[model samples]
Target: MKRKWDSSDERYFGIGIYRPKTVENVGSLWRTAYVLGASFVFLIDAKYKKKSSDVLKVWARIPLFQFETIEAFIQTVPYSCQLIGVEMDDSATPIQDFFHPDRAIYLLGSENNGLPKSLKSKCQELVILPGEPSLNVAAAGSIVVYDRILKKVNRSLLIQ
Candidate 1:
């Protein structure tokens, strides 16, 4: 589906989780993604269930793509759009230092286990949030989206 933003504003992004184990997390993440202007949300090897946490009924406002496998998801990534992985890994750049791509899709791992190595290797860029012992999947995804929005706003202010 076409995005709400105009063509001149090339920046657009989607957020999704891989093998998410909790419905609440998916609902909360979906709401956050919609509120933060994410172009879309997705699930990899998982299914979403209705939950009360999504007060905005984000399903109606945003698109959610489900892929049976990682390869299937990779096939749908838009041309020229980068796939970014959000995980706590030694090779990942810290969130504060990472630059938000003009067109990107941010993928987060499940609540129990972080991103698998195969998927992590495919990401053009991987960003790690602050703190140890990891964080809730929904919280981490929200932070990534928020950071992207914050940086974009700061960049526009500078250009003006």
Candidate 2:
């Protein structure tokens, strides 16, 4: 049977994984981002093409950027794209009420520590998972990517 994922987006956003400890997780995140129409996937403070995960294969198609630091990566984001942090913080807006930007870079922090305080301070917006304690890095990033695609698709339908 044909799948809905065959669809495309005119303006695709990006997703990122920050210092992920496992190769498998990053590989999974990259695959999800690719399947969901993300324009790119990025790595922060992590070695590029050093792991034997399936990520290298996916990287062949989707552009992946390696940043020396989160600050450096944040600086590279286009002004038109909002840097949204996926973290559970007291000040974070619940994902349900938050407005997914038309162009966004959804950043997921390390799986063990969540987002760093310095990175949190820099994000334009922080979105909380709510109810769940937290999710594994890849799982959380996939949810955010899926949410963006769903909202974008629905918005386009309304305009038509």
Candidate 3:
């Protein structure tokens, strides 16, 4: 399900998985991000270390942004883009109800604890998937990314 990279950056949204601590999750996330046509993935507190020797590997080809702080990550995004924090909060609507943004960032948090309360406060929107107490970080991320892409693709048909 790898996506052919778009020549021009227009219309597609971005996926940001906040602070994943496992390499397995990172690999799983990489595959989904590629399929969803996300511009890049921001990995906060990424656990694996990248040795200089790993430069030419397939993982290196993927866009991975590691930030020291969530504030720094937010700063990197353009103000024009929308940021949605995925978490289980009272105000959050189901992922299906959240509107797909023309330029967006989907934030998936750490496995043990969800997105930090402080970070959640900054999000323009928050979304939740029902019926489960929790989800594996990678699985939750894939669901959100796929759902967003599906909604956008469906919406396009109505415009034509």
Candidate 4:
């Protein structure tokens, strides 16, 4: 990729995975986003070798925004998009039970604490993927993206 921001806005199904540790995981998510056609990525406390470098080569061509906190980032997203938080909660709906909105922003929490309680309050819904408790952050993100894309591609069949 040329590593330049594309004029085209990120697709309708774009995702915003919250603060993640390890560039490797971040890189992997970026790759997934690229495959999923995500418009851009927002990083909080993300370590960068350089603002623009080969390490960020995956996201170079994509629109990448850096923020100090989740609160700030969420403010920037358009109100029209549904902000979803992926977490393990008593009331969390299964990821499969829900339908992906035309404009959705899936929020992936950190590895240790999951999503902050305060932030979770803002999500339109909280979801949990059916699996072992050990699902890594990157894998969780990939699953959400895949699920949404599947629903989106099969919308016609679903209606019938």
Which has the greatest lDDT? 1
- Candidate No. with top TM-score: 1
Alpha carbon lDDT at 19, candidate 3: 71
**Which ten contiguous residues of candidate 4 have the minimum total lDDT?**
47-56
lDDT, candidates in the order shown = 0.91, 0.82, 0.76, 0.73
In model 3, what is the error at residue 12, expressed in angstroms?
2.6
Which scores greater on TM-score, model 2 or model 4?
2
Clashing residue pairs in candidate 1 are: none
Model 1: residues with Cα > 4 Å off, grouped in runs: 1-8
RMSD of each: 3.7, 5.9, 5.8, 6.7
TM-score for model 2?
Answer: 0.87
Tens digits of per-residue lDDT, candidate 3, 1-160, equal 8768552345756676677777777777766787667777778766555443443453555587788788888788786788888888899988767887778888888887879988898889999987678888888889888887778778766655
TM-score of each: 0.92, 0.87, 0.84, 0.82
Query: What TM-score, to 2 decimals, does candidate 3 have?
Result: 0.84
| Over 4 Å off, model 4 | 1-11, 49-56, 157-160
The 10 consecutive residues of candidate 2 with the worst lDDT sum are: 3-12
Query: How do the candidates rank by TM-score, highest first?
Result: 1, 2, 3, 4
- Least accurate 10 contiguous residues by lDDT in model 1: 47-56
**Which lDDT tens digits does candidate 4 get at residues 37-94?**
7777667655544324345466566766777876687788786788888888877899
